[model samples]
Target: MYLVKIIKLALVSGAIFIGVHAFAQDDNNKAVVMGNFQLDGQYYLEDSAISAVVPEETMALSGFGNILYRKGKFTAGMRFETYLPAPVGYPAGASWSGTGIGYRFAQYSDDLFDITVGNFYEQFGNGMIMRTWEDRGLGVDYMLDGVRLKVRPSDWSEITAIYGKQRFNFDNGTQFVSDDLGQGIVRGINADFDLNSLLDSIVALPGQLSIGGSFVSKFQNNNSARYDFPENVGAGSARLKYNIGGFQFSGEYTWIGENPSAQNAQIVNIPDSLDPSVGLWATGKGVNLNGTYSTRGFGVSITASSLSNMAFQSQREAGAFDSWINYLPPTSVLQTYLLSQLYPYATQPNGEVAYRGDLFYNFKRNTTLGGRYGMKLELSYTQVNSPNIAELNDLGTSRNGAKIDLFDPGDEIYFSDFNAKLTKKFSKKFKGILFYQNIVYNNDVILGAYDYDNVPTKGTVYSDLFVFEGNVKINKKNNIRFEAQALFTNQHLQDWVAGLVEYTVSPHWFFTVIDQWNYGNGDGDDFHFPSVSWGYIKNSSRISVTYGRQRAGVFCVGGICRVVPASNGLSISITSSF
Candidate 1:
């Protein structure tokens, strides 16, 4: 009976495909369909050794699919999402269960203008003043739902405008329009001009030059009982970029009006006073500068930023992962090795002064230092500190926060990292990398979690890490790679070592095994974490499965972070694009 049903389904599918192809051939304007899908599910298990808990549901699943339709100059798309009692550590609240349309939009574009209505994402001026975006790995989505317009008046100039509300949470089976939107309304406009092109008719210049500016505002009803909030908050930014030869320079400055909310309440008012004008309700500002010089095999870059009370959100009461209006890029580089990420840093939005520098050099082959194969060397350093704040009291004796100096670095150091890496190619099929880093992490300031298991982390923790990685191409179809890492620290979790082995059968199959051991615990109760996984890839689809004990730690991507709970589970992931 099953075989007969399968045959019937195949025949019907073939008939439909043939009919569609003939219809397309008959019409000049044929419609095209494209989309992608992904699913992540985990089945938990009880593990006393790792303090892993199995929830009442026993399993958790999250998935989404996007379908897009396009013709000539018009396009439309929608996304379907489901959380079935979201995965552990997911930012999606309890209300995000069941299935619903997460996003939908219709857009039209031509040489003169482009317009979008429904849902969209955008960024302006390094994203310091406004950025509506999402990162699935961090479980953060701030996509705007409304209308976006872009106009190009000339080849050298363009303008963009937006009016929208940010997506907050999904209500099960509700109307897809504004049911899941935030309470505040947002509006913005931006203009960019290419100076070189604009001045070409008047004068001939060197290199390239460009300038842009943006103004964004958010509106929300004032319902606070204790403080008088601004019904409409506004922010503006200006940016400039210049490039000549192999050198590039860019900078942006953003300023926001006085906006007080729950996140900055500590510094919003004096220690015992509530008068809005007496405290740090002063205007906020952010300045970012970047410069890069690259030529041949050597290059260098520098980035510096200063921010003071610059955390802006569409709604004053929104949480950290919701309704965010701006994005502050981090100064530290992202780590690739798993163990190196244990101490990843997050950008501080309230007030911070940060700097980062990087240097890269490559040695030519047939030299004393480069050997028969070429070698590459990389060095980087990053530091972050709190901006100085003055007191608001009469005598200035009490430590009541008042005004902030953006360039002033206070005594407290939030985080810092100094790292170096060397990559060498010993042969055509052999390559190796050696990396080392020294990190200073302030748990009290960074994680805001001072204690673990009744033991305090003692404010600041210092650690040194080393990694050794090698890869070998056994043949045309097979490859193997291995990594060994060690982290030494006296505070927090203490000393640890980890190793990973991965094998790949070229084009389709791969397997990996990894383990971490904490052997320096003071209580003599050491712990070991192990995991294994296998994956297969074909065309545009891939699937993988892993079963192991996961340690409780912080996971971060692009300066944003989320806490991942300890779990012993069988996990599966599938993704496809068509």
Candidate 2:
């Protein structure tokens, strides 16, 4: 009822504007219009064996369309979203199952200033202090619903400010208030400066230098009486970057004020007793550093970070990816292979130190190591550990959390992984990649309660994963690919093996089938998870239908994660843009 009117209005205005300007003699009368849409629907079937059942609703649909209009310095866009009985395990609760104008924004800009109202998304340097963005795949659409302003005062300086409310997601579809606009009102300011552009004569070098800073604060009324939490939580971050030809380095440091809520309990469990006033939310701080070097076919990067009580959420009681005020950059490798992602690491925001290093090189052709074609090698290693923690005793009335040394090594470890890959092309139509990985995963911390009862040792999981991918082009119009993956472990879930085969016909259609088997679970309850998908593509439009048994696993982004439930169903998706 509401978004329909806006759509009609937009269509009418677009038609009028185009009719009056497209034929105008003026060269600037180039009215621009573009739109994109996506539809995802699923038909749930009851299969007690795989735990896939939809009692109340047999099917579900989720779709959205974004229409944008731009004419010279003026721009406007609107997003329409609808969800009918949202899919299972889609963290965003059921209250979002209605058609509405999810996002709308209009902006006018020139050489000096840009302004937007209604809705927008923005991020500060490295997104350490504040970032308002969206990830449809993760059900994270926390875009800001307010006004944003940006200005370039000089050639070397830029400033941005925003006052908005986050997009609140109902934890589930059934019971939630219509607080779709978010629960907290947040305000933030960010600025960046380039020293080289401001003063070139003083530092006349072949490199570049830049610095940026951000300050963000979110205000939400506190209702808890047990703990006196701050209604206004403020976080600030500063970042610096410099590059000289082949070498580059960047870092960001952030400080956050104290605020306690659900994840960071007001009462914490220590050695023997519970400290009511001490939790992970007691005045936190974090720092992230990264360095990179590249030469010819050789490139490498190293990233390190320390997080101490750095969990910042708009609503202290929110769960999953809801009402997030700020994001913490993760230091783990984003695995692409199937087996590598089986026990992927998620960032620990409370107190942890993490680091990752990666190197890539391509050997020259006709060499001893390289055959007719060159061979490519990639190596990556990542590790994360708990921060050094010690008690802090102030006045009897003023009890805070423990003090954490950012760089000091702690005894407890969260996760660690080391992986390497080698890729080579034998001929014009064939290529393959071989990979190996070793991972030390702490299921206690990552899987939380889901794995606590499942793990027998109540300890860490030592596992190894191997993967091989080969692809071939069977002519100008046909292509084929295959994948073989295996994971070996002595802990929970034990060993798993997976295989995939895919065939694609150029410019149109593709089919794929994959099967994953948990063959060494120690328990005789081994299972098989298989799926098949067919996809078609035409221009900017594409559609795919998949019928499969989905395995339950932890999906993560940055340092945050959401659990996907196991189900067996038919899913269809279509996307188009014009």
Candidate 3:
């Protein structure tokens, strides 16, 4: 392993040299330099009560930095990453060891065309058919390494072409392996047009119109000996957008060829054994539609979407978040409150029908409903249901694994949420917010056995959550804030209460203390989770340190998620940009 690390570092150094030497060849133009830095370190502490464990290493560090240089239309950059034996909760199978250059890229651009070589991120049409991005918070990075070209001949039309391989892991070697599945080749093209811009002289239009389409295909050599899996899978998508004055509408639909992988593979249960293999591949498709209306003091939007057998991966064997060729847009309202998010929703890519709607309003300044600073309020509702499934055989052993329309709402409900928030300013120096929510969730369909148990829980969890928060301005450079929140429930983790308080001193320092207590659990003993943090900020840099117990749960963004383990530790984070 040590030898491998040395080789990777040497190769990375050579690449950097080559890139710099090439840039130096352009002596006429002055180069602009830029850089960024971030670091995070964790010291583990044991708390058996929360199932938190301390590994033998006792400590871990994970950090990265980026350096770049630009001269005219040409530019190049490299990102350095290090992980001294990644922390306990880091994504499994990620090789965050031995200092190495994880990402390096070079690009050149002009008014008509742009070209990039090495590693890059790309997305098409709301990311329904293809997307390659990174979310460090979730430990998800799906960058593609190869070549990309974009062309815009006129103001109304644009085209993009890319040929690359999905990055499975971090290494500068002949071979790479992902925790879920190895490497796979990907090729795609996308085109878009501004219909209004193209037809301005022919006809007058009141609103803008745009259209786009993308086709992406991936190839992975078949590794299974008994089954002839699909070596090449293709997905296509089309989208339309229109905005007229204060009203707007947009929609996207995706079609995926028959491709099955470990994540969404169809499995059947029988009287003799649990069948892990039945259907070799699944026919997949999905759709999303949304509309919004906005005026001076009010706004409203509604969205409906569905995904069925749409787990398209570069490799049929990839599981979890590895090698995802596309992303299913998040269908639920993202809850930001600490307690409100304790039971956040996770997207079901295999088969689900979901809908969400939101409304926001602000009262006039002098009206009774407005108070001193015009009052603001918002309302949101979201619901999701399982996709209608029909068994191919005349038996009840299948796991409801059948092709169905993305718009077909199944009979079984999976989850539902209704929430509202109201904000008001009692005085020039004081402000407050009140929130309420009701959520109904099916554990068996969503979280299964939440406590890491094998036996599934067969019941619905109904919870009503509430929160009251306020902020006070003491003076020019001092302020205070506090929060009180609770969730009333009779199922799953049962009932819980949480409180928080914070103080800030101008543009420099802040401190916070918070506690979440589970007063009602299956076990009689009440568990209280407490944590403290202090932060310092200056210009584009900031630093914070926290010590506390973290609950085990699944965290997600953009429909991708990872399981986080319970942990009690002292953690520090520092960030800066230049």
TM-score of each: 0.90, 0.90, 0.90
lDDT per model vs. reference:
0.81, 0.79, 0.80
Worst 10 residues of 2 by lDDT: 172-181
Error of 3 at 102 (Å): 0.7
Off by over 4 Å in 1: 1-29, 92-95, 173-182, 266-279, 394-400, 448-456, 523-526
Which candidate, 1 or 3, would have the higher lDDT against the true structure?
1
Runs with alpha carbons beyond 4 Å of true place in candidate 3: 1-29, 171-182, 267-276, 394-401, 452-458, 522-526
Per-residue lDDT of 187-302 in model 2, one digit per residue for the tens? Answer: 99999999898887676656899999999998877554555668898999999999999999999999889867555653342222345455534777889999999999999999
Per residue, candidate 3 scores C-alpha lDDT tens digits across 301-408 of 999999988887776656566777788856778787777776667778888999999999999788999976799999999999988886554254443346577788
Candidate 3 clashing pairs, residues 3+ apart or interchain: none
lDDT of 1 at 491: 80
Displacement of residue 306 (Cα, Å) in model 3 is 1.0
Q: Write one digit per residue (lDDT tens) for candidate 1, span 1-578.
A: 99999999999999988877676675654888999999989899987665675767999888889999986578899988887756776764425567788889999988899999999999987888899887654567778889999999999999999999877766553232232233668899999999999999999889999999999999877655655668799999999999999999999999999887545553332222455334435678899999999999999999999988888888765666667788876778888887777777878877889999999999999998898998999999999997887756535433245677788999888999999999999998999999999999988777822222423266788989999999999999999999999999888788888899999997999999999877776543537779999999998999999989877667765446666667888999999999
